[model samples]
Target: MKQFPTHIVAVDGIVENEKNEILLVKHRDKEIWTIPGGQVEIGENLTDALIREIKEESGIDVTVNKLVCISSNTGTYEGYNGYGIVPTKVMLGFTCSFIGGELSVSDETSDSRWVSKERVLDYITNPNLIERFKAYLKFDGNIQYIEYITKPSYDLKLKIKI
Candidate 1:
Protein backbone atom coordinates (compact mmCIF):
# COMPACT_ATOMS: atom_id res chain seq x y z
CA MET A 1 0.00 0.00 0.00
CA LYS A 2 1.17 3.51 -0.77
CA GLN A 3 1.35 5.99 2.06
CA PHE A 4 -0.53 9.23 1.86
CA PRO A 5 0.23 12.65 3.30
CA THR A 6 -1.45 13.77 6.46
CA HIS A 7 -2.66 17.13 7.68
CA ILE A 8 -2.63 18.48 11.19
CA VAL A 9 -5.88 19.69 12.74
CA ALA A 10 -5.62 22.41 15.36
CA VAL A 11 -7.95 24.71 17.22
CA ASP A 12 -7.61 28.32 18.34
CA GLY A 13 -9.95 30.48 20.36
CA ILE A 14 -10.66 34.19 20.49
CA VAL A 15 -11.63 34.37 24.11
CA GLU A 16 -13.33 37.50 25.34
CA ASN A 17 -13.82 38.61 28.90
CA GLU A 18 -16.62 40.76 30.28
CA LYS A 19 -14.39 43.76 29.78
CA ASN A 20 -14.21 42.97 26.01
CA GLU A 21 -10.55 42.06 26.27
CA ILE A 22 -8.98 39.23 24.26
CA LEU A 23 -6.80 36.48 25.63
CA LEU A 24 -3.34 36.23 24.04
CA VAL A 25 -0.47 33.91 24.81
CA LYS A 26 3.19 33.87 23.79
CA HIS A 27 4.59 30.39 23.37
CA ARG A 28 7.98 29.63 24.94
CA ASP A 29 9.53 28.98 21.56
CA LYS A 30 7.82 31.78 19.68
CA GLU A 31 8.52 35.50 19.90
CA ILE A 32 5.20 36.70 18.46
CA TRP A 33 1.97 36.62 20.45
CA THR A 34 -1.06 34.62 19.34
CA ILE A 35 -4.36 33.31 20.63
CA PRO A 36 -4.11 30.19 22.80
CA GLY A 37 -4.59 26.90 20.98
CA GLY A 38 -2.99 23.59 20.03
CA GLN A 39 -3.29 20.41 18.02
CA VAL A 40 -6.21 18.08 18.74
CA GLU A 41 -5.23 14.79 20.25
CA ILE A 42 -6.86 11.51 19.29
CA GLY A 43 -10.27 10.85 20.87
CA GLU A 44 -10.70 14.59 21.51
CA ASN A 45 -13.26 16.79 19.82
CA LEU A 46 -12.48 20.29 18.63
CA THR A 47 -14.19 22.06 21.51
CA ASP A 48 -12.69 19.76 24.08
CA ALA A 49 -9.24 20.20 22.63
CA LEU A 50 -9.71 23.96 22.57
CA ILE A 51 -10.83 24.09 26.18
CA ARG A 52 -7.95 21.91 27.27
CA GLU A 53 -5.43 23.93 25.31
CA ILE A 54 -6.72 27.19 26.77
CA LYS A 55 -6.50 25.86 30.29
CA GLU A 56 -3.09 24.32 29.74
CA GLU A 57 -1.52 27.31 28.08
CA SER A 58 -3.13 30.16 30.04
CA GLY A 59 -4.81 28.59 33.06
CA ILE A 60 -8.03 30.17 31.94
CA ASP A 61 -11.38 28.41 31.63
CA VAL A 62 -13.47 29.27 28.63
CA THR A 63 -16.62 28.09 26.87
CA VAL A 64 -16.42 27.65 23.15
CA ASN A 65 -19.21 29.76 21.66
CA LYS A 66 -18.99 29.27 17.91
CA LEU A 67 -16.55 28.55 15.15
CA VAL A 68 -15.63 31.72 13.30
CA CYS A 69 -13.22 30.52 10.68
CA ILE A 70 -11.53 27.49 9.15
CA SER A 71 -8.11 28.07 7.65
CA SER A 72 -5.55 25.82 5.94
CA ASN A 73 -1.96 26.72 5.29
CA THR A 74 1.02 24.94 3.82
CA GLY A 75 3.79 26.43 5.90
CA THR A 76 7.37 25.52 6.72
CA TYR A 77 9.03 25.10 10.11
CA GLU A 78 12.56 25.16 11.47
CA GLY A 79 13.48 21.88 13.10
CA TYR A 80 16.64 20.65 14.83
CA ASN A 81 18.07 19.53 11.51
CA GLY A 82 17.03 22.39 9.28
CA TYR A 83 14.08 24.10 7.67
CA GLY A 84 11.44 21.58 6.60
CA ILE A 85 8.11 21.82 4.90
CA VAL A 86 5.40 21.03 7.37
CA PRO A 87 2.20 19.18 6.62
CA THR A 88 -0.79 21.29 5.73
CA LYS A 89 -2.30 22.70 8.91
CA VAL A 90 -6.09 22.93 9.17
CA MET A 91 -7.10 25.14 12.06
CA LEU A 92 -10.53 25.96 13.36
CA GLY A 93 -10.86 29.37 14.98
CA PHE A 94 -13.58 29.88 17.55
CA THR A 95 -15.04 32.65 19.62
CA CYS A 96 -15.14 31.75 23.27
CA SER A 97 -16.44 33.37 26.44
CA PHE A 98 -14.28 33.46 29.51
CA ILE A 99 -15.82 31.27 32.20
CA GLY A 100 -13.43 31.59 35.13
CA GLY A 101 -9.90 31.07 36.39
CA GLU A 102 -6.98 33.27 37.30
CA LEU A 103 -4.72 34.26 34.45
CA SER A 104 -1.46 32.32 34.54
CA VAL A 105 1.15 30.95 32.14
CA SER A 106 2.25 27.35 31.71
CA ASP A 107 5.39 25.62 30.47
CA GLU A 108 4.22 26.00 26.90
CA THR A 109 3.62 29.70 27.32
CA SER A 110 6.16 32.28 28.36
CA ASP A 111 3.54 35.02 28.94
CA SER A 112 -0.20 35.52 28.79
CA ARG A 113 -2.38 38.58 29.01
CA TRP A 114 -5.72 40.15 28.19
CA VAL A 115 -5.37 42.83 25.55
CA SER A 116 -7.91 45.37 24.48
CA LYS A 117 -9.34 44.84 21.01
CA GLU A 118 -7.77 48.02 19.77
CA ARG A 119 -4.27 46.93 20.74
CA VAL A 120 -4.53 43.27 19.82
CA LEU A 121 -3.25 43.79 16.30
CA ASP A 122 -0.22 45.59 17.65
CA TYR A 123 0.82 42.53 19.61
CA ILE A 124 -0.03 39.85 17.01
CA THR A 125 2.09 40.52 13.95
CA ASN A 126 1.89 37.20 12.13
CA PRO A 127 0.14 37.61 8.81
CA ASN A 128 -1.78 34.34 9.12
CA LEU A 129 -2.87 35.11 12.67
CA ILE A 130 -3.86 38.61 11.66
CA GLU A 131 -6.04 37.17 8.92
CA ARG A 132 -7.66 34.78 11.39
CA PHE A 133 -8.30 37.66 13.78
CA LYS A 134 -9.85 39.65 10.98
CA ALA A 135 -12.15 36.72 10.24
CA TYR A 136 -13.18 36.65 13.88
CA LEU A 137 -13.97 40.36 13.79
CA LYS A 138 -16.05 39.93 10.67
CA PHE A 139 -17.93 36.88 11.86
CA ASP A 140 -21.71 37.34 11.50
CA GLY A 141 -23.41 34.08 12.25
CA ASN A 142 -21.37 32.67 9.39
CA ILE A 143 -18.11 30.77 9.19
CA GLN A 144 -15.27 32.06 7.05
CA TYR A 145 -12.96 29.75 5.12
CA ILE A 146 -9.43 30.56 4.04
CA GLU A 147 -6.76 28.59 2.20
CA TYR A 148 -3.25 29.77 1.52
CA ILE A 149 0.33 28.73 0.85
CA THR A 150 3.34 30.09 2.74
CA LYS A 151 6.27 28.15 1.28
CA PRO A 152 7.65 29.69 -1.92
CA SER A 153 5.69 32.82 -1.08
CA TYR A 154 2.60 33.90 0.80
CA ASP A 155 -0.18 33.39 -1.68
CA LEU A 156 -3.84 33.46 -0.76
CA LYS A 157 -5.68 30.69 -2.58
CA LEU A 158 -9.25 31.04 -1.39
CA LYS A 159 -11.25 33.16 1.05
CA ILE A 160 -14.98 33.16 1.47
CA LYS A 161 -17.71 33.20 4.07
CA ILE A 162 -19.84 30.09 4.26
Candidate 2:
Protein backbone atom coordinates (compact mmCIF):
# COMPACT_ATOMS: atom_id res chain seq x y z
CA MET A 1 0.00 0.00 0.00
CA LYS A 2 1.13 3.54 -0.72
CA GLN A 3 1.80 5.87 2.17
CA PHE A 4 -0.61 8.80 2.48
CA PRO A 5 0.88 12.24 2.83
CA THR A 6 0.90 14.28 6.01
CA HIS A 7 -2.11 16.39 6.90
CA ILE A 8 -2.20 20.11 6.16
CA VAL A 9 -3.62 22.65 8.59
CA ALA A 10 -5.81 25.36 7.07
CA VAL A 11 -8.08 28.16 8.25
CA ASP A 12 -11.29 29.57 6.77
CA GLY A 13 -13.33 32.56 7.92
CA ILE A 14 -17.10 32.82 7.62
CA VAL A 15 -17.73 36.51 7.15
CA GLU A 16 -21.30 37.62 7.55
CA ASN A 17 -22.32 40.96 6.16
CA GLU A 18 -24.84 43.31 7.77
CA LYS A 19 -27.38 41.97 5.29
CA ASN A 20 -26.71 38.44 6.55
CA GLU A 21 -24.83 37.15 3.55
CA ILE A 22 -21.71 34.99 3.69
CA LEU A 23 -18.59 35.68 1.68
CA LEU A 24 -17.44 33.17 -0.95
CA VAL A 25 -14.52 33.11 -3.35
CA LYS A 26 -13.98 31.35 -6.70
CA HIS A 27 -10.48 30.08 -7.35
CA ARG A 28 -8.94 30.91 -10.70
CA ASP A 29 -8.62 27.24 -11.59
CA LYS A 30 -12.05 26.05 -10.49
CA GLU A 31 -15.63 27.11 -11.09
CA ILE A 32 -16.99 26.01 -7.76
CA TRP A 33 -17.26 28.66 -5.07
CA THR A 34 -15.96 28.35 -1.52
CA ILE A 35 -15.37 30.36 1.66
CA PRO A 36 -12.24 32.53 1.72
CA GLY A 37 -9.25 30.85 3.34
CA GLY A 38 -5.85 29.23 2.85
CA GLN A 39 -3.12 27.24 4.55
CA VAL A 40 -1.73 28.43 7.91
CA GLU A 41 1.90 29.21 7.24
CA ILE A 42 4.61 28.01 9.58
CA GLY A 43 5.09 30.29 12.61
CA GLU A 44 1.89 32.20 11.71
CA ASN A 45 -1.04 32.34 14.11
CA LEU A 46 -4.30 30.74 12.99
CA THR A 47 -6.27 33.96 13.31
CA ASP A 48 -3.54 35.85 11.52
CA ALA A 49 -3.54 33.31 8.70
CA LEU A 50 -7.32 33.58 8.42
CA ILE A 51 -7.09 37.37 8.18
CA ARG A 52 -4.31 37.23 5.65
CA GLU A 53 -5.97 34.60 3.45
CA ILE A 54 -9.31 36.42 3.38
CA LYS A 55 -7.61 39.65 2.50
CA GLU A 56 -5.48 38.03 -0.18
CA GLU A 57 -8.30 36.08 -1.81
CA SER A 58 -11.26 38.44 -1.40
CA GLY A 59 -9.65 41.75 -0.57
CA ILE A 60 -11.65 41.97 2.65
CA ASP A 61 -10.53 42.43 6.23
CA VAL A 62 -12.15 40.44 9.00
CA THR A 63 -12.17 40.02 12.76
CA VAL A 64 -12.79 36.50 13.98
CA ASN A 65 -15.87 36.25 16.17
CA LYS A 66 -15.19 32.68 17.22
CA LEU A 67 -14.29 29.26 15.95
CA VAL A 68 -17.33 27.57 14.43
CA CYS A 69 -16.03 24.17 13.40
CA ILE A 70 -12.98 21.95 12.88
CA SER A 71 -13.07 19.76 9.78
CA SER A 72 -10.88 16.76 9.02
CA ASN A 73 -11.00 16.45 5.25
CA THR A 74 -9.71 13.32 3.55
CA GLY A 75 -11.36 14.06 0.24
CA THR A 76 -9.35 15.23 -2.72
CA TYR A 77 -9.67 18.98 -3.31
CA GLU A 78 -8.25 19.99 -6.66
CA GLY A 79 -6.46 23.05 -8.14
CA TYR A 80 -4.34 24.15 -5.19
CA ASN A 81 -0.83 23.10 -6.20
CA GLY A 82 0.62 21.52 -9.30
CA TYR A 83 -0.35 18.19 -7.82
CA GLY A 84 -3.93 17.13 -8.56
CA ILE A 85 -4.90 15.98 -5.10
CA VAL A 86 -4.66 17.47 -1.62
CA PRO A 87 -3.73 15.29 1.30
CA THR A 88 -5.63 15.12 4.56
CA LYS A 89 -6.54 18.62 5.74
CA VAL A 90 -7.58 19.87 9.14
CA MET A 91 -9.44 23.11 8.55
CA LEU A 92 -10.51 25.49 11.31
CA GLY A 93 -13.63 27.47 10.50
CA PHE A 94 -14.23 30.81 12.19
CA THR A 95 -17.20 33.13 12.35
CA CYS A 96 -15.85 36.54 11.43
CA SER A 97 -17.08 40.12 11.20
CA PHE A 98 -16.14 42.23 8.23
CA ILE A 99 -13.69 44.98 9.09
CA GLY A 100 -13.14 46.81 5.79
CA GLY A 101 -11.90 46.65 2.17
CA GLU A 102 -13.86 46.69 -1.06
CA LEU A 103 -14.72 43.49 -2.89
CA SER A 104 -11.89 42.59 -5.24
CA VAL A 105 -10.00 39.62 -6.70
CA SER A 106 -6.43 38.37 -6.73
CA ASP A 107 -4.48 35.93 -8.87
CA GLU A 108 -5.50 33.14 -6.56
CA THR A 109 -9.18 34.14 -6.81
CA SER A 110 -11.27 34.91 -9.88
CA ASP A 111 -14.39 36.32 -8.20
CA SER A 112 -15.86 37.11 -4.82
CA ARG A 113 -19.46 37.60 -3.71
CA TRP A 114 -21.79 37.88 -0.75
CA VAL A 115 -24.24 34.98 -0.73
CA SER A 116 -27.28 34.43 1.42
CA LYS A 117 -27.14 31.38 3.66
CA GLU A 118 -30.29 29.93 2.15
CA ARG A 119 -28.85 30.32 -1.36
CA VAL A 120 -25.24 29.44 -0.65
CA LEU A 121 -25.58 25.95 -2.12
CA ASP A 122 -26.48 27.56 -5.42
CA TYR A 123 -22.84 28.62 -5.65
CA ILE A 124 -20.88 25.95 -3.78
CA THR A 125 -20.94 22.25 -4.66
CA ASN A 126 -18.03 20.50 -2.95
CA PRO A 127 -19.42 18.09 -0.37
CA ASN A 128 -16.82 19.03 2.24
CA LEU A 129 -17.46 22.75 1.81
CA ILE A 130 -21.21 22.28 1.91
CA GLU A 131 -20.74 20.41 5.16
CA ARG A 132 -18.65 23.25 6.49
CA PHE A 133 -21.36 25.77 5.61
CA LYS A 134 -24.03 23.63 7.24
CA ALA A 135 -21.84 23.29 10.31
CA TYR A 136 -21.35 27.02 10.32
CA LEU A 137 -25.12 27.54 10.44
CA LYS A 138 -25.63 24.89 13.09
CA PHE A 139 -22.76 26.14 15.23
CA ASP A 140 -23.62 27.14 18.78
CA GLY A 141 -21.20 28.66 21.28
CA ASN A 142 -19.32 25.36 21.23
CA ILE A 143 -17.25 24.09 18.36
CA GLN A 144 -18.47 21.37 16.00
CA TYR A 145 -16.13 18.60 14.90
CA ILE A 146 -16.59 17.09 11.42
CA GLU A 147 -14.86 14.68 9.08
CA TYR A 148 -15.33 14.62 5.29
CA ILE A 149 -14.26 11.53 3.38
CA THR A 150 -14.61 10.53 -0.25
CA LYS A 151 -17.50 8.23 -1.06
CA PRO A 152 -17.09 4.42 -1.50
CA SER A 153 -14.23 4.50 0.98
CA TYR A 154 -16.67 2.94 3.49
CA ASP A 155 -14.73 4.37 6.41
CA LEU A 156 -17.54 5.01 8.86
CA LYS A 157 -15.94 6.77 11.77
CA LEU A 158 -18.57 8.81 13.61
CA LYS A 159 -20.79 11.77 13.01
CA ILE A 160 -21.67 14.50 15.55
CA LYS A 161 -23.02 18.00 15.05
CA ILE A 162 -22.24 20.56 17.73
18-96 in candidate 1: lDDT tens per residue? 9999999998886669999999999999999999999999999999999999999866554455646467899999999
**Which number leads on lDDT?**
1
Q: Which candidate wins on TM-score? A: 1
Using Cα atoms with residue i matched to residue i, what is each candidate's TM-score against the true structure?
0.91, 0.84
Tens-digit per-residue lDDT, 42-113, candidate 2: 999999999999999999999988888888867665644478666777889999998789999999998999
Model 2, residue 114: C-alpha shift (Å)? 1.1
- Which stretches of model 1 miss by more than 4 angstroms? 75-85
Backbone clash numbers for all candidates listed = 0, 0
